[model samples]
Target chain A: MNAVLHLAAASRVHGEGATEVHALRGVTFRAHPGELVAVMGPSGSGKSTLLTLAGGLDAPTAGSVWIEGTDLATLDHAGRARMRRTSVGYVFQDFNLIPALTAAENVALPRELDGEKGKVARRLALTALEEVGIPDLADRFPDEMSGGQQQRVAIARAIVGERRLILADEPTGALDTDTGEEILRLLRARCDAGAAGVMVTHEARHAAWADRVVFLRDGVVVDETGADEPEALLVEESGR
Target chain B: MSIRQAMLAILEQGPMYGYQLRAEFEQRTGETWPLNIGQVYTTLTRLERDGMVEVVESAAEDGSDRTHVSYRATESGRSEVSEWFATPVPRTQPPRDELAIKLAIAVTLPGVDVATIIQRQRSATMTSLQDYTRLKRTGRAANPEAPEDLAWSLVLDSLVFDAEAEVRWLDHCEARLRRAAADRPAASAHATPTATPETSDGVAR
Candidate 1:
């Protein structure tokens, strides 16, 4: 079981001297292929910092982040950018779809930016859109679609190339409960099909969708759970 | 939680023997709440005493004294069933939640580390929550179109929602405790007797 995303004692500190802030401290985390891991914490607990470090959007002040066997710190700016486009996909709370682009074009932008042919990128985007259950909405612009639809487009973009790692930060924050569950279902299905996913969420109900949960607090890893088989409910009724 | 009301509700459809009523109950509740034969019979007797059901007794086999019996809901019982459905279950008397009580007690005790209590419970509840979700995923894919799926899933949904709420509450409790610890001045250390009331005021967070 190779981990698609791995952080070894990762620490992220902002500034120094009297005004320093430690967003994360000595936190080792991993998300393996075919698994979805949820990161949960309070507002200042570094959940977002951990996600950015794992996705290579930010560097750790100490330790290292490895995505699909490549160390993020070892890669230069161009190298990290290339890694992000090729292997890592990010889903934000706001959906992050470009209003100017249609759903297909939005999904295809990632593939096109990575230097694939326009026709080929669009084809790939169409396939990803189909996987997210919105193939018919490929031509719909962000404003023309509902929040859930836009999120589907965002997820299609994330998984466009069968990207090996998916990073979602509060991915369902903008949607209603049923729609959020639908998005979670899509994320779960993608992970089940073999991508590693790390999602940062404050809602425990949303975290319930993940295969495992990592709890952070005060810039450190506080606890971890959900890897083992789920135990029986307390006071389950006996005898029928 | 009321076997008596549940049995009456099932009997409203038609007359049913004790075992049959139990089967119907288990089938509808996704087999989560199992009832022993004795419980069914006991509840049936109570329902009969309350004028909610009527018993039809017959001699068993070869002229034996012991009898076989079936139960049918009386008109009153049918009305009760409808009333139960139409009215919301009252929350005035919630079952004792031992975890909540334990944490509440632990927070007030001297030398108690409330954060550890919350963390351990949160971990356990999250695992349970995950299990419920796994059950839901497998259950959904296994029988997506079955009519029984809704009943089963609704049961699982209750469990998932409860566990999630517990975890969130635990998180809330920890945050409140942390805020209390931060707000109390070092001077409060010397005035430990008066600090309890002030700490209780930290409940807002």
Candidate 2:
């Protein structure tokens, strides 16, 4: 099977010499198109670092990162940025929206920054907002919207460019249970729309929404289980 | 500790209200452990039902007032705790966390879009890290001199450790994605090696 994204012997470190901390220790994984994979780990397990490196947001100290048949490390900074803008969509836990901008404007920013025509970007942005079930809220500013609404807008922005890869880091962290679930449903909807999504979350319930869950510990993939497991592992642990 | 053992341990210390039980458990364990109030009460009620513990006295029954119910461990409860203490801890099987499996399958699944997912996860993780850091800072600032400060510090350490680890993992995932993308054509070619059909006429299938 063709991997849409692949990591080979990837490692990331901070600082140098004795002060250096190896956040990712020769870690490797892959994700294909149309897959919704959840990365689960306790604090300091390097899950987010893997996501960012996969998304071309950062460079690895060793090994390579591939997205859509291209080595991101081989790309020039501008080239990497272009690929990310055109192919990758990101949804953050706190819904990283410009509070001053209307939802439509926020969704359009990526395309607009990529130098698309204003009208074309806005039209696509509106379509993306509709995809996330928040078309009516397009005119509302981030501050005016609820947490779920803001997240929907974030999702809208993420999919507006028709990016094939969508990464969400704890997309529901700030929301209440119901609201978080709603955000997760939106992410699922995005996958249904043919965009593969990856989410990093501590909440097992949130991870349960994904088609698969990857467990990490101390910067390594420790275990994995299908989403169809009879009960969430965390719940089972609590039960024990 | 098992739920029954935990209840017995709490009662052995002295009578405690439901909320008090929850707080004390969390405090004693440095909040590395989590117990919902419902879980505590449910366990306590179960102990009472099993005759392992009994309510010595009920302070009040009014709905609006704080009702304090004091419970003491029975002889059986004491025996249970003793057995619990004497028993060696059971080694649990390693968790088969669903997320890791999903990620592994996602990486190899035909036509799956792995990079986008990582990007989305990176954003979400960063946001969570920020929130956790803020909460940790606020907690430390609010209780600089509290006796439970050490416990709070431990929680903060855990939060920081998780957030930092997640961020690092996301980076590693991205790098591997880039490499896989670069190697796709060659890998795919290697995966589809030609094979001869073993029929009457050995023709390539």
- C-alpha-based local distance difference test score of model 1: 0.83
User: With candidate 1 superimposed using the best TM-score fit, by how many Å does residue B29's alpha carbon deviate from the native?
Assistant: 1.9
- Per-candidate DockQ values are 0.41, 0.02
Best lDDT among the predictions, by candidate number: 1
Report the CAPRI category for model 2. Answer: incorrect
Q: Encode model 1's per-residue lDDT on B11-122: one tens digit a residue.
A: 8788888988887876656556778899888888888899999988866668879887888889999999999889898899998999989977876777766666678789
lDDT of 1 by residue, A174-240 (tens): 9999999999999999999999999999999999899889888767777788577644442232221
In candidate 1, list every pair of residues with a backbone clash.
Answer: none
Q: Which ten residues in a row have the lowest lDDT in candidate 2 chain A?
A: A229-238
Which lDDT tens digits does candidate 2 get at residues B1-205?
A: 3766976877788877788777766554434457778888888898899989888755675755655787788899899999999988866864575556776887777656565465456555544544443333344422457655665556655655675676577667756665565566556522221111211221221
Candidate 2 clash figure, as a count? 78
Candidate 1 local Cα displacement, residue B115, angstroms: 0.7
